[model samples]
Target: MQQDIRDKFKNYKEENVELSKNHSIKFEALLQQELHQNKPKKNYIKWLSVAASVMLLVSIGIQFYPNKTSEPIITKNDNDTTTKQITLGNISPEFNTIETYYTNSINLEISQLDLSDENKELVDSYLLKIAELTKEYKNLTQELNTKGVNDATIDALIRNLQLRLQLLQRLKKQLNEFKNLNTKQNELQII
Candidate 1:
C-alpha cells in the first residue's frame, strides 16, 4: 500500500515537473515579483518606529490597567513597595486549636470514667506515655517548621496520629473488656 502511494506521488511529481517547465518563465516572473514585495521595504525605519510606539503604549497600559485584584490591595505604604496578600496561608493557629480541643476532650472523657486503682494507675501511665509522645511530636514539628519542611511532614504526622488513634482505640476497647470482666467477677463473688 505504501509503495503504491509512493508511486502515485512520483507520477504526480513528474507531472508537476513537466508543468513547471512549461510555465517556468511566467513562474519566474511571478516569483521575482513576490520576492520583491516580500523583501524589507525602504520604510522599515518607519514601521519599526510605529511598532516601538505601539509596544511602548501597551507597556504603559499594562502599568496602569493591570488585571484587577479579586482581593483588596492591602498596602504597607503608598509606594509600590508593598507585598501581595495571601489569605489564611498559615495553619498553625487552626492546628493548635483543633489539637487543644481534641486533647482536652480525651482528657475529659478519661477522667469521667470509673476504674479500680490498679486500672487507674495503668491508664495514668498510658496517658503519661501519650503526653511524652505528644511533646516529642511537637518538638519534631517545630524542627520541621524551622527547616522549612514540605507538606510531607504534615502528612507523616497525620499518619502517625492515625496510628496513635488506632492504638488508643484498641486500648480503650481492651480497657472496656477488662472492666466488664472485673464487674462480672465481682458479681460472681457476691453470688
Candidate 2:
C-alpha cells in the first residue's frame, strides 16, 4: 500500500496538474478552521491571565488599605467628657512595642522592690522622683497630641522612658547596697 501511494504521488507530480484559481483562498480557509479548533485552549489561558491580574490587583489593594482599628479610640472619663489617648504606639507598631516594653520593665522593677521601715524614707524619695517624672511624661504626651509627631517630641518621649527605667534601676541598686550595709553592721554587733 505504501509503494502504491508513492507511485501515485510521483505520477501526479509528473502530470503537473495546475491549481484552481481560488486554491490559495480555500487552503487558507481550511487552515484557519483547523487553527480555530485549537484556539479554545489559548483562550482559557488568556482568561486565566486576566483572572490572575484581577486577583493581584485585589491583593495589592488590600495590602495598601488603611486599617480602622489602628486609629485612636475616644472614651468617656469620670467627668463625662471624651478623651482620646495618644502614645508612641499611635505612630507605629514598633513604637507601641517599645512603649509597652519600657512600661512593663518599670512596673516590674517597682513590683520587685523590697520595702521596710528602715528604707521607708528612701523609698518615699525615689517614689517622689518617679511621680514627678510621670507627671512630666503626661505633659509630653499632651504635647505630642497637640503638636503631632516630630523628631524632638519623639526623642524626648523615648528619652523620658529611658530615664524612668534608669532611675528605677538605680533605686534598686541603692536599696540593695543599703540592705547589704545593714547586714554587715548587724554582723559586727552580733560579734
Report RMSD (Å) for each prediction in the order shown.
Answer: 14.1, 10.7
CA RMSD (A), model 2: 10.7
Runs of candidate 2 with Cα error greater than 4 angstroms are 1-72, 75-84
| lDDT score of residue 38 within candidate 1 | 62
Which structure among the candidates has the greatest lDDT? 2
In angstroms, give how far residue 176 of model 2 lies from its true place: 0.5
What lDDT is obtained when candidate 2 is compared to the true structure? 0.86
Candidate 2 — which pairs collide?
Answer: none
Model 2 lDDT tens row, 70-177: 546545597886667677867886787778888999999999999999999998998899899889998998898888889898889888889999999999999999
Report lDDT per candidate: 0.62, 0.86
Clashes of each: 0, 0
Q: How does each model score on TM-score? A: 0.42, 0.60
Clashing residue pairs found in predicted model 1: none
